[model samples]
Target chain A: MKTLIVVSHPEFQDSITQAFLKTSQAGLDDVTWHCLDEIYGSDPIDIQAERELLNGADRIIFQFPLYWYSAPASLKIWEDDVLSRAYTYASEEGHLKDKELGIVTSVGYPKSAFAAGASQSFSISQIMIPYEALAKQAGMKFMKPLVIAQFGYSTDEEKSQLLVDYQMYLTAKYPFSFNERETWMIQQLKKLASGNMKNHQQELDLIIQELETGQDDLNDLKEQINLIRNKEED
Target chain B: MKTLIVVSHPEFQDSITQAFLKTSQAGLDDVTWHCLDEIYGSDPIDIQAERELLNGADRIIFQFPLYWYSAPASLKIWEDDVLSRAYTYASEEGHLKDKELGIVTSVGYPKSAFAAGASQSFSISQIMIPYEALAKQAGMKFMKPLVIAQFGYSTDEEKSQLLVDYQMYLTAKYPFSFNERETWMIQQLKKLASGNMKNHQQELDLIIQELETGQDDLNDLKEQINLIRNKEED
Candidate 1:
């Protein structure tokens, strides 16, 4: 799938994390990196061309540092000038649909502060909801964001490791999971073997395992839960 | 409560919603509306003064059109240039703590497109999370945003109404329910009250009635839900 990585640091030459990330993505076959500030440095933004690029891409990644907790301005201008409701929705020109969109962000804050009593008040998922909403309007799939927090403070080694991890995260089918119950369910299901499904620990495990491995005469997850509950009572 | 409203439209004089809002807010006792684009029209940003202005405020309102999914470039430059980690967060100097930060935005898209099946992928909240997180790191409160959708497409009468509503929204003494859930709950509460909350529904009585006339109760808005559920039941 062709991916468009829109790098949005005003001064990429001075930005360590975002600049490095852009460089790392170089040589990838299907990925095209667009530096927003550089492109719009002199004249008005080329709206028609931007529309075409997004239209052509399979996935669009907004790659940038977290500036005051939002993206740089070029992204905003691009959105206002390029993605028109008249064209994208009301008229016969709904060019963006079923395409995937995600953010590859590198922030300079520590991960610890993104919680109550920490420096920041909310979590990553909470803050990024606005972007998700934007994607929904454009009829694009909201892929999981690839975040590199505390980039400024992170050691070179740590930053390098995160860069590798971020690259892997991009190609992964799904990377983000919000909500406590969903996270809990995912954490439980990860332990079950895809190699051989057997010997579930309890009713909960049996249901989970059956749902995951398609065992125990349960075609669907809800049916598996019922079967496990029935087995537990018997 | 000193409020610094940073209005960042490229051409503020030509703007109806922003100009009206600014004019309305101009005479308020503790409100200072700084037109960002005007401040840095021909030069690089004056980072020192911007920092001082932010330092001076109890609340910082980032006012702009919801370009792409964020603010204009002047804001991005102002944010990046002024809110450096060396000075704003990690310095021996003071941090931006105990302060309130929020957004006042206008976008061209209808709010419906910000939903799951709509063309836009992420909600406005999703795109704005990074800012909330930034506010958190600087030890500031990230308040719920004031969004005006389909800005240019609206009628002149509608635009005037939006200006007044937006004016009221900015100067509002909203109690602290900072995260997206509370914001979302409040938004949904506003939603349950009116079909047009996305585009219209500005007055305090309607909004306050939805919130049940208090703040802390919004912390656990199950009461608001029950209140709505009861209304729906009726």
Candidate 2:
């Protein structure tokens, strides 16, 4: 699937989180990293070009730092100008129909601060209703959001995990099931072993073999359970 | 109370709804109808001047036509530029603390199409959560939003009622109880009778007297109920 990441941040160049996210998705073959401000700073958006890009992508991601509990003004400007009603409305032209819409937002507050009785007093799901509504209106499947909180304060280990998760969000299959994630990780490991990291190929091969065995065991357990259930029914 | 209505609509010059709202609040002395796009256009927002305007107002209204289930880009731009962290945080400077934040938004869909199982599938309250969250963070009282849906489809009587409702949203006291609305209407009627509409002073005076009598009777009934409650307590 061709994944398009439409990034919007007022201080895009200065954001460490954005820089890290950029680096994380650097080598993805099918991902298009399109930053709105970088491309069209202070210029009117070329709506036809943007619409064409949207049409080409199977999954579109709105990636931004949450400003005032929504995407920055740049992305909103893009939406207001580019997503014309004739092209967006599902009941009408339905150009974006059957595509996927995803949100990857980084918040300044702690993740725990977003809940009913928490400091933010609203869940991220509640805050993202507008985007979900947009996806609904366009007949697109809205993916579960990937929220990164307090990236500045994250430990190195957390950052590594974030890197892997960010990569998955961009390129993994829809719904991101455990099986798909494992398959994706093994594919990445194989690529790494075959590429410039040839010295670590032996270690990577061992790890991949172990993961495959684990998957086989899991499948066997599932098969045994199904057999037991079928026998009981008979 | 001084009201600062920060209006944001990309196509403000052509909106019949905005024109009607402007005319509705024409004679109000304490209300400031500041349209952001009209003032700033494509230029950068004047942060200092905008913050000063916010500081002076007892009620700050974000009036706009709904674009993509939220305010237009211009409003979000105003918010991102003008509301700095040091100025708006309730736990810190609290510049907007104890003030009121009101929303007056017009929608293209029918009013009934904004609930579960409807076409819009989200209530106005659900969609306005971001602004409400902002109000909470700033220690401001969030007023019930004035949602004008399908304004072009409204009848003459509905438009007239919308005029009154919009005025009340901007200038009326907080918690807009029935008593307060009635008091506000009477005050407005008195102003009209004493001003340019003086030719109909006799009819206005008679109507005012009838309203006053109704108020007096309601007060008497309340007092009687209180007396009965006291007797019951004894």
Candidate 3:
């Protein structure tokens, strides 16, 4: 599926986290990275062009840093201008109907600080109601948000896992069941084995083989459990 | 109490609701009506001057029509440019500490549409978490929001009640206990009697006298109930 990442950062060049995220998806196919401030740059947004971008994407991602517990004004300006009621309402034209809407927000505060009694005193889910409501009005599926909290404090291993998670969020199927993840992982490994990692092709192939064998074993175990339960019922 | 109403409406001139609200608060004392779009039209916000206005007010009201379940972009721009972290954090300078933050938002939908299973499926309180969280960070008291819904559908009596409620929201004491509302009403009526409404002076005076008598009788009844409770304890 084609994914569009609509990024809004006032100081995009100065942000290391943004840079890392930009680079992470650079090699991914069918993913469009559209940065608002970079393109508009204080000019009025071209509503037709913006709507075209939304129309082309199967999955739309609003990616930004959490400014004042919401997106920066540029994104809001875009929302106010481009998302016309006639085009957005489910009972009307509904251009965004049945599409997936996702949010990727990075915050400076620790994840633990977002709770009823914590320093932030509000969960990310609570703060994202506006977007969810928008999704509802447009008849879009609201995907679970990917909150990158205190990314600077994350360890190298954690960052590696985040990279995987971020890529999966963009392209992985809905619900992201374990089997779906395994299939996506194997495909990525096969691409890597044949592409830039030609020297490590043998090792990557072995790993892919092991994953496929594990999947087979899992299916066999499920069948055995179902058969035993059926016999007990009889 | 001094009130600074920072209003942000892109189409302020065309909005009948905004016009009605503006006229409602026209003769009120110690209330500064600051319209952001009119004052700073296409101009950058003067951060220091905006901070000074906020600093001067005992109560700060963010008045706007709800666009896409949040305030318009201009208000968010003002917030990002004006409320710098150094001056806003309660642990730091905390310039807004102990002040009250209020929201005055007009919505197009019916009020009943903002419940879990309703068409909107999100309460105004849930949608306003960002502003509430901002108040929490600034150590300000977040007042209950004044939501004006379907103003065009309101009857003349409903509109009159809205005027009084809006005035009370801006000027009345916090918690707005019945006694406090009564005192505020008496004060406002007295002001009207002495000022522009002097043509109905006798009638207004009689009404004021009747209200006072009713208040005194209620107080006496409360005292009698307390005395009886004390005797029961004995």
Candidate 4:
């Protein structure tokens, strides 16, 4: 699908790293990069201009650093304006219902700091609920977030890996579905132990038993995860 | 202190309840309520104008309806534009170093869904880490969020009380600092279960025994409660 990247970094000119990524990203065909601040400047958004942009693109990716636990101010403003207009348009007569929504957020903290036992209290995706919800309201596919953690501490190799991972995230067909994730995890775990399910076989057997004996709960979990995963798409 | 309320509801007009709250919020003094989409009309923000707004205010409040798990789109835009500018400004010279930030959100889901193991795996504030981090980066105090749960389903009484509580939160002199919250909770709990320790000898002795033992994780519990309460504020 054709994609539009709504990049929201404030000082794009001074951002050597992000500018570098953008240069590579720009090289890709079938995608357009819009630096929101440059487009909007000081005036309010022209509803028509935004509607046109939304209508033209099949996927819209929100690109920014995860400031505070959310987006920068202009991105928020863009949501309040652009997305609302889309909703209004849809309510009147559906428009842009099949488009996809995504996020590319750069974070400063180490990945582990976001765990339950850590000082920060929640993982990165948990901190990204608001964007997930936005995708739902606007009727777009909520693509998994492309996260770059410890941006300040990254080694050159790590940074390069992050860039490649980000590109993969933006360009690839989604990795797996919510229902399929548990199975994927189980398979990966088995693969890691020399393709021997025997080591973790008891745990897998127990999980299978649980899935079979408690079909209702497992189904509920699957349904719930599906809802979360499909929110933006619906 | 003076406060700025940046409300991010997409359709403030059709929704009578939040709209009513907005109307009520209008007459309050020392608070600037920027109903973002209403003002910006999908246009970009004027950086100088916003800087002036922030420079003028003592506290900044991001007010919005909880969509899925976040503030509206425009609020994100605002953060991206305004705060990133402030970040660059601080990097180059310095600005917005001492301001305070808060969130006041209205959620459609009831409070039950936010618990651990609940359908949604995180609370409102847990989902809003980007903002908290931003406050830290901006060198601003991140106050407790003000949340109204199951807003559309809230009873008349619930909303009535919420209005008063919200007003108090906006004007209160006591900022919800982590340092003082545990002490505050103990004091509040004491008000409910026991007489003043100095006045009641036996109760005081029992409480003092527990206090000496230090068994209850009052501090950690207080932090969690504070997080939820603070989410309400934002």
The per-residue C-alpha lDDT of model 2 at residue A150 equals: 98
Rank order (by DockQ, best first): 3, 2, 1, 4
Tens digits of per-residue lDDT, candidate 3, A90-209, equal 879999999999999999998889999999999999999999999999999999899998888989998999899899999989778888899888888998998999899899999999
Report the C-alpha displacement of residue B147, candidate 3, in angstroms. 0.5
Docking class of 3: high
Segments in model 1 whose C-alpha atoms lie over 4 Å from true places = A14-24, A37-43, A87-92, A110-113, A149-234, B90-92, B99-102, B106-131, B141-234
- lDDT of each residue in A105-210, candidate 4, tens digit only: 7766677888766645567777777666555445557887877776767788987777656555555456545445445444434444444557777776667655
Residue A109's lDDT in candidate 3: 92
| Model 3 residue pairs with clashes | none
DockQ winner between candidates 2 and 4 = 2
Candidate 2 lDDT, tens digit per residue, B74-114? 99999888877778879889999999999999999888999
Which lDDT value does model 4 have at A40?
78
* Model 3 spans with C-alpha error above 4 angstroms: A223-234, B223-234
Could you give candidate 3's per-residue lDDT for residues B1-234 as a string of tens digits? 899999999999899999999999998899999999989987899999999999999999999999998999999999989998899999999999999999999999999999898988899999999999999999999999999999999999999999999999999998788878888888888888998887999999998888888888888999999999999999
Candidate 4, after superposition: displacement of residue B80 in Å? Answer: 6.0
Per-residue lDDT tens digits of candidate 1, residues A118-141?
A: 666666666667676666656678
lDDT for residue A96 in candidate 2, whole number 0-100: 98
